[model samples]
Target: MKLAELAKELEISTESFIKFIQDFDLELSECIATNFDVKKDFEKFAKENKSFLKKYDADLGQNKSVEDIAKNIQQPKDKVAEILEKDKIKVYDNGFYKSSISSYGIHQKLGGNYQFVYDYFGKKTNLSERDFIGYRDLFFFISKTLDPFLHLAPLTDWGIHKPAGIILYGPPGSGKIFWANKIAEIVDYQFKQIKKYYFGTSFVDGRRANFNDFLVEMMKEDKVLLFMEEFDVIMSERSEEKSVSSCDEETKEIVLHYVSQFEKEDLLMIGSANSLVDIDDEILAPGRFDVTIPIFPPNAHERAEMILHYLKENLSKDAILMKILETNNAHHLPFWKEISSKMKVFSNTMIIDFTQSLKKKIRDIYLKNSSLKITINEKLLESAFREAAAKLTGEYLNQVAQFLQDVSINNYDDFPKRIEALKVELDSYKMVEKPIKTIGFTHNGDQES
Candidate 1:
């Protein structure tokens, strides 16, 4: 839809749409000469303009002209032009007036919607619950780093080095790959997934040399995120002495050179590895990876939420069983997915009974092994659910929940003292949990056991 067509549809005048285009540029010939279909161009322009106008609606209400609004927003004229062009608004004549179509603008186009790998997974595949602590922090850090570049001209230097690199290292299934994809989506950067063979091949075969060329071309395209999974292949520490024939030193050297180039050019680079301990120290030095984040396994609270989300999508009726199995496995995504699939195969009534039986089995297992009783009361369960939900949503509500859960579960003997200590820490965040009151002893009546 050209801006004029959109305006006509919305009952807006041609003069108004032309004025919007003029705010971006005066050269109508160049703007409309590009090859874009009128409807597609108009849709693109409408989306971008909606976002921009919403952002600066107050200023627009002041009745400023397009030029004045662009100046006030500090956005480039080309960007404004792109937005207008997307809306099907175009320059007629040199400055005179004629109606014609042209190419759509990239800047005005909306990036793809936020998506997750689990979305594409089979319905039967139960994805593990996500641990929100690391995910939220990771998102915040990346957002802060990329915010400056999002709205400005591609040419404007945000002091971002080409090939800007970030390393995410942790255990497998710890959400490293998921986080990388999410970051690319959030930042509106193109993600190029690099394969392991690209790094593992012998230099003599030209594999090592070809990788560098590929990266250089990718960087030149501007605002691309190069994601290297299993980065350990290229970044593992070199042996004390050089190894012969089978080992290739050229691969390491080529990787280092490109990494250095990326750092210098300001291109974004993101690498994922199962363990940082095995990675070479040289690759982790300041310039190569400006930031390193660890994606740790999910905690109890996160597990609960992961279970809940999985159940809602896969087994909506079996809430009780979902909680029990999730708490027991609380380790990774696959387990949740697996159990959920099983639960779905059974009858609804059977699902409830099966969940109860599972909970009993888990409790019996714990009871037989331990000297101390680990009771999960309503209060504790509620706390875990809340914490997990907050993390999943990327909200930082109470920082102390994680610490308390760790202390309580890992150190049962000292739980009381630790809880007291945690209370002091929680005070800092204005989070106060009442002490669990002991009403009476067990039915045995031996001092209310």
Candidate 2:
């Protein structure tokens, strides 16, 4: 029904009716004749909105407040207030305060529809639980630690608090970020990337206030997975040697703030860094960031999994996946499997690089020599894999590989020092000079190293 008609029928003002429609996050261009007709389906929409209002009312039953309910439901009270809007819900005369979501109606909306909720906030990737390969032991560790509170059990009946913090320390492209994201996906929590760019402002007071406000806002969410990459930049152990910037002090405050929250809230902070030892002792102790994991290069089986995945993902358009899987063909699944077996201890990035290089090699050949046909066969992929493996695994080159994975471009000031340190570390091991040998893969998956 049109706003005027609905208002007249219900004996309310037109402004009031319009306000009701606006509650559902609808924007009006204002009622020209066509604009009014465009909203003809308002009746059905209003019914759904009525249900949400009813749920909100039930949530507030027995004169319960938003803050109490927010704590009970693990949602930020401010977020509840935002969703409920100030018009429909009462607000404090002085200012805003924290709140939580306590209504079962909201829970009904939230229970099985995490993706929907995240979609309302913003769309997530289509990556599912299976899409996250490896990290089996780490997954178990996370689940075991968080099992106490990572459920929908009633708060009044049982004791529950925010789960312990987790630090995923690894070299770059070791899958720390990917695993953290997958964890958030499976847990069905709000996933937020703690972008360093947000803290790049120069004004001290503004920086401190911004950090404080953002944390306050984040706390209101029901369940949040905060992923901080290059985490040591902000949360590294505060040292007297460092320059005294206001943001430094502010960063210290925020780190301490999250530590306290982790003890009693539902938020989970997942930070990734080059090394766990770089973090402060207090933060790494029993309660805050209790789990410090070291993710290393993938093992043989894991490397194989990653190799097959990337190969299919990038080269599938050329029907290379079929050649690998088809048993009757000379270059079949076992041939690929054996290739993956040989790629032991390869980093995930190296596998991706291998795929790109292999594809580029073929494309270059096709361009340079039009008469030579490029076939996506086992031998071609095997040769590319062999070539990449030789470069990544040789004695001095292995040290270089580690250096590339461990160092970030932002550490330009310390690059020389870091390189020297790594060189010394590599030098400590017995030096062995060996030829970079390339292995040839056969139809039967036999290889000569």
Question: Candidate 2: what lDDT?
Answer: 0.52
**Would you list the C-alpha lDDT of every candidate in the order shown?**
0.45, 0.52
Compute each candidate's TM-score over C-alphas: 0.39, 0.51
Error of 1 at 272 (Å): 1.1
TM-score of 1: 0.39
Residues 198-245 of candidate 2 have per-residue lDDT tens digits of 554435564453666666667887888888887655566767776435
Identify the runs in model 1 with alpha carbons over 4 angstroms from their true place: 1-134, 145-163, 200-209, 241-248, 263-266, 314-449
Best by lDDT: 2
How well does model 1 score by local distance difference test? 0.45
